[model samples]
Target chain A: MTETESPTGSTLTIGVVKETKPGERRVALVPKLIERLTRRGLKVVVEPGAGAGAQLADDVFTEAGATTGDAWSADIVLTVVPPSIADIERLKPGTVLIGFLAPLTNTDEVAAMKKAGITAFAVESIPRISRAQGMDALSSQANVAGYRAVLLAAQRLPKFFPMLTTAAGTVPPAKALVLGVGVAGLQALATAKRLGAQATGYDVRPEVAEQVRSVGAQWLDLGIEAAGEGGYARELTEEERARQQQRLTEAIGGFDVVITTALVPGRKAPTLVTAEAVRGMKAGSVIVDMAGETGGNCELTDPGKDIVAHDVTICSPLNLPAEMPVHASELYARNLTELLELIVDTDGKLAIDFSDEVVAGACVAGRDEEVN
Target chain B: MTETESPTGSTLTIGVVKETKPGERRVALVPKLIERLTRRGLKVVVEPGAGAGAQLADDVFTEAGATTGDAWSADIVLTVVPPSIADIERLKPGTVLIGFLAPLTNTDEVAAMKKAGITAFAVESIPRISRAQGMDALSSQANVAGYRAVLLAAQRLPKFFPMLTTAAGTVPPAKALVLGVGVAGLQALATAKRLGAQATGYDVRPEVAEQVRSVGAQWLDLGIEAAGEGGYARELTEEERARQQQRLTEAIGGFDVVITTALVPGRKAPTLVTAEAVRGMKAGSVIVDMAGETGGNCELTDPGKDIVAHDVTICSPLNLPAEMPVHASELYARNLTELLELIVDTDGKLAIDFSDEVVAGACVAGRDEEVN
Candidate 1:
């Protein structure tokens, strides 16, 4: 294997294609990363207007050593979203595809890629081990979503987040409670605290209390610890669920803003904010339900809508990272770059070692049935 | 005069009227202040749904020692906006009225109140003195507008306001600039800083440099000063204005967010942000023009509307205080209460003292020829 040589002794080409999903403004590769790929003797081809959504013009990509061409015909295709079935038909048998292919849920897409004999990598399927942390696109995008959720809540709430002493009187700081102290929830708490709100974080996993406090927010303990394997809370027992709901309902009323980010990998999001809890909240308070895509953490949440229930604004924005396309695309590109470094050999030849845990875990198609 | 007696030997009746102006959600009084008025032996009457916009139900006011009735018929009418001609006609000849009368601009409204023999006190006309600071409704409302402007800018921006270090990469903090150093501008700078943005403030009045720095923002010095009378900047000379604009255009390009609050009394807002400046800014940058009601400080601003010009979002929301009706009403009610304490004698009878500077300055009508 040599620089600029693929397994078949031809120049290896990485293609950056424009995202086709509706409202998906992020791009998988940014111009800033073009040099890194090209420096390794990889030829870069970007479809015209591929990075437009992320504010990178075609000229910028061209200036960064990328050529405008048919990206679908390249050796490897980079995308923000999973390619459609029609897009899969455009790729050669040995072509490699990489992006957020929902392997667990979009089984049909995975089967289609397998039938086409295309090697595919699902960013969401990347292992959570220490070595693969830089390739964790889910956590990177969730960080953006969490930060955006707080800004949306602040914009909609008819009050100041921080306390202020003016000529008329002093206004007390708004109290914000974040349910589920995952990466997104912790980021939401940090953002709220940055805006001068008195922030509090709650999670069924008691171990996350220290992480919440590190962001300058209080930790709410409800005495329900469901620390499950793989860093997720276990499904609560029937009795535990009832107790959690009652305690959360009582505690929610005291906060002016609430952000819910509890989500199960392959299950509907748990209903953390019930209708009764919403009714008890003060008028003009805000709730940003980050689990809107998975049936929402709030009982009254209408996915991808902003509604007022019981005089409280409930915002359930889907794909919040797309709303902030520039930074979201930049981070996603970096995550892809880290993953690329693992699969691409030091000599710049196409090489995928299945023995590597990250490479094996992220592969969804074009592998032996037993290995898969 | 007795505690329960008016000039006409009747109980002093203070009425809280529902604001009739379009999009004006704030009421003249809130339920929390009802007991304060009643404790002075004054009878309080609230129009039905007067505090609805502020989330204070009619029953809440009634529970706080107020009665639901025809607010227009009370001896003293309290309002959030200047009353219309039809409303003035409903008032008794000797009735006292107070609110943001816009005495200098809305001359016809003042003349109508005078012709109807109603004693009108424009909150905007309140003298800027230490004793009258609590009665300065303009300052109070401006503070809310300033705080909201930053939030609006943050929401519209596609990037995070604060810097973040993640596994993917580090995001630099957003740079925010505020043009004007008045109450609203100062608050805008403080709020932007609170959200962790690198904030800078610019003002024609060089004296406000200290106030800008006190809010944790750098002062942009253009080497041109226009210190005017009565705590406002004077009109800049043509040469100085050209020099200022040229310098500002260069400085504005470096900021991600710009909030403009530069306005002259009874005149169109100065063009602090030119069209060229908007074009010079990076794509997805935001500009919130707080001077929208008096035209805008931005060349491309559409007053009372949110529009994008030259790839920059320009939000010129009018009456921002009304958008946050809860705190806006609370602060305005407190300001009115402070003014009421000055006019309402210890015996609880109406005392019109022209000798007092605040009273004389605030009185827009119902005074003798010279005193007015």
Candidate 2:
């Protein structure tokens, strides 16, 4: 596949630098991506120890036909994490840098990226679609976050989830209920069920009931009906909300572990589980709210901390994906590689054509001056 | 049934109290329980306007055969949320107090419950079993919490979850992943699905893959075997932990929402999702960590706050369940009534039977005082 598509006349140069942040592992460009880049006549340059944490030796870059040199002097700089203001200050204007800048809420970080005069490609900003699936960062890391949330819950939960017939006594299975049905919520349900808990789920969208039922657990519908354009929920009518809550209240008293994941982008999360419900739960019941970063769904939830309310503990953790940085970075790097190839031209030259929907969508935050 | 069991009955005194905590909407005992108590030849006494937030008026309590009076002076004192330390101190010695008392981490509160010499029963400490399920505060409340979490996540999410085919374009369904399969997690999953998102779930327990698949999501297994005695996972082994990371890294990129519910009882929550995972996620993705009350599963999750990292926002909301306190209280009241009826003696009298497993298990937390 690489032979015919190789850029014969020119070779493209991309730079890799050591991440300044302490405890930063994983590089933006991994050695595994070299063959693809080489076939396109794209040459990668790396600073010393760029891939040290990932165990990719310096010689590995050389073996892959990548040049070892002064990283800051390259036409485009590729980084893992975000570069510090000082690092950006050293860069020449019009240079392109690709990595996770955390643009949405990182005012200072986004400004820094802009000030660097570098075109930024947030790997985390990749869209989710069949064509963009390979470059979707949210899925790569959320998968880790979901797996980890369950492990955390299992550790703190007092009793087992599944029922057992023991000689001593009959141990009933734990009833697990999932809220929000998002990536982490689904993972939590799967994890709880795997642990032998009888799983059930609730959602506002009646259409999701099938998905919930497909998971071998009962699908709890609050009888909420909603329709919106382009994968966004139209705001609910107050009456619909009331009916939904009414149904939810009646269905609530049976579960053990309550994992909540509900949120609106760029807004405070709505509350799903109420204090009275927490009080109604069994002793030693546990809840892990994944929306802690945006606010929380459980009344007892305290973002980034642990609080026991009415004997029910609500836990909200931050940076769930980073805890597994090794895999996270690897996945993100692959995504970056895929996204980069699409933007690069056949001449092995840099070209970001925003006319393409994928490029335009991914480049939403960038100003005209940031990229050509 | 009520007429059949009236031979040995005398009017039992039931007491209700106002919560002393700031912004507390929950009353001592709700109307549903009061009706049950009254049916059992119990005279119900409630503080004026006790159930206002719960929408049960004082007239309703009075009409149901309850008397209004100073809750502190009643024969039995019940309050929602938790009583202030001062209220505990003021209670008469040996008076029975029933409410949500967070005992494990609140040593001072536990000490107060003990020092006051009140036979305090933390409603949340109820055991979870077939017979004891009705009394299970954790289950009842978690159900509400789980429902609320999904709403919160949906509200905060940038887009709606369900797919839409409109004149504008084909809007692919938002993708959601759930982390744990506990009650809250399941609810979140169901809610997210209903909101029109493609849902997926993962867990450390392989047994839950079927459940996740049943929920209409393609289940991705981390392939880490669990070692839990009661169908719960013990702390993961170090090697298994690495494998888990690998599994999540492969799966996280496509999700638009992630809900996390992971915790351990009486212990700090294990760090599951890390910052790298957050960075790897898409810019608009939102993560709701339900583990905020415990030390969060996400390393970057801050309890009771909203934070944006790597363009992905993480939220850990505190007291989410309280946001919808009215229904929460109602559900709890029914659960308590069911529980109280289960333990009520045939003589129309309250009985504390330590010999019963339900009572024995329920009497788990608190000041550790014993009363007959």
Candidate 3:
């Protein structure tokens, strides 16, 4: 955590708990993260071994000057991942718990958090924008996920990606296709290009062709736009899906490796590739679904598993962010630190102004409005 | 069929068959397609009941001056769909058959075409260039697919796409996300923008930001360009995938609807949306996977089916062009006609030029090294 100057005197209490879930090793708050809060007259606490996987120990927390007190004593409890029931019970009413709580998926846990009288903040819900850049835990993690997805595709592919001037016969470059053109898709495209795979991207938005071309791959157009309001995909009609498939069928069966990064916010993913389409591809093609944990983009894909169809391997990794925990954590820390700084007022204090759009948009727990 | 007067002396043969596949009533080739051949002095055969689904009748072929043949015979036999074995066997050795035979998925079947000594041409393989514009079957179908994709998404979504001054109150227009940014993707963007759906697009290629913005949607940059040679998406390194997912996860939960149209040529479609990502999406959100025929970009997608997951509906319909068969077929016919015109000699004679890249690329089946 970097130092933040405070013009006025104020104090904040921050708490940390050891990860309790099986195979869970990430500290809710990291060492540098704790340091950032403490330098600003904020109190920090640790329940021993919080940052063990990250190589920080109890002594490190103490050195940071975080108080080792009962979980309920802190004015604010900093958590890693979501806090478990046992951990939640330890907190007193009205304590603010900040973490990546599974608020949407785990409604029961949200209920528990509300019942315990805790004001909860979900880091995962932070939006991606210039103002919220510092608070985007997902961006940091996704950056890593995109890179990992490409590596996985390369590993699964039988041929090398780049053109090789080897002593043997000159090696032809591999052809790569990026399904989605989002952050992961862009990373996959860049990585594929860097690895020497001829990469092209397809999107329902034709405007991305130039970008795909800019990345050095011919943008294969299958002409299907489902753009709706707010820059999101609209529900497709029955006939339209069929048309897109026809165009896709013409283009889907020529690449050696494909990495997909397309996703709809707050909805089930649309099936871009069908089993029939899979059957059309040549044997030994590899596909990496970065969106696998939610299920997968591939019809034959199994979450957290790799399956083969028509001699092609479809990989769906669930916890891609966890795969590269170090850098992911570092980036996440930076984002969180930035977000926290925004709320810290002129005096060394935290403020949640419900009237502001930023605060109101993220305060989904409904405590302020009692909607939840 | 449009009249083709390019081939004055030389005659080419055309073949037609009644679509046998269920729901496959539209003939792959149409009258306008034959017009160019007729003008090229090509003789064509039509099987009874072809083109009935598209409201075209055998008399339409007869009226076009094409001989209705009991047995398939001709120097060049034009087909709308993949030739059946019986259809293949029906052809004499050294006959030319052209249509979207799907060489990528039907390689083995195509290999059989070679064994049967049938000269085959896959129109879908036409390169993207000004010279090949007339022959670009993909573009023709994609235009329709794009138009249809937008309409589909608009209809399925609960909210209206266009902003309206309605009695129900000034309704905020719907929000949509177009996952892939290809030709179809861009068209979708433009359509969505026109239809009043505020649309945004994501692509691995950074160059597409302008295109997205051009179509009235914001471009979210992921900071990594996976582009390699020719502006194609480069295969990403492992680290990149992680970062990409982290960013996308955050972006995915904010939109109302998503249309994913990501794919690779001759490969299994890459997975874009994860089941986890979908869980964060709101109920009533919709996803249309234009790449559904090639394998879906979504985790919960079942190609050729409609799926409801996490209270969201996912539609992956293959054969989109078939739905708008009239317009799609007409466009395809025009393109075929243009290519045929380009293939004619100054004296209106058929010129199977091996020197021409457009002819060479499109004429996949060769006779003695010459494209013809």
The per-prediction tally of clashing pairs is 0, 210, 158
lDDT (10s digit) by residue, model 2, range A251-313? 666676777777665567777787777878765577888889788877668898988887576
Prediction RMSDs, each to the true structure: 2.3, 13.6, 18.6
Flag regions of model 3 displaced more than 4 Å: A1-372, B1-10, B32-34, B70-72, B84-86, B228-232, B344-350, B367-372
**Candidate 2 CAPRI assessment class:** incorrect
Which scores higher on DockQ, 2 or 3? 2
* Leading candidate by lDDT: 1
Residue A150's lDDT within candidate 2 is: 61
Model 3, span A1-372: residue lDDT tens: 122232233376667776676555455565666767766667777776666554455776677566565645576676657777877788777676777776667677778777887777787665544566556665555655666677677655644455533111234677888887765676668667754578888777776677777757667677677666433457678788788767765577888787777676655666667787788886567888776755666777877789988767899887665554434554555655665665555454767655555545554463553433
- Chain A TM-score per model, please list them: 0.96, 0.81, 0.86
lDDT, candidates in the order shown: 0.89, 0.66, 0.66
Candidate 1, B70-145: lDDT as tens digits? 9998988999887788878889887889999888788888899888888899999889899899999989999989
TM-score: which candidate is best?
A: 1
* Per-residue lDDT of model 2, residues B198-292, tens digit only: 87776667776776776566666666766454334567878877777656755676677787776666577766677767777765578888889
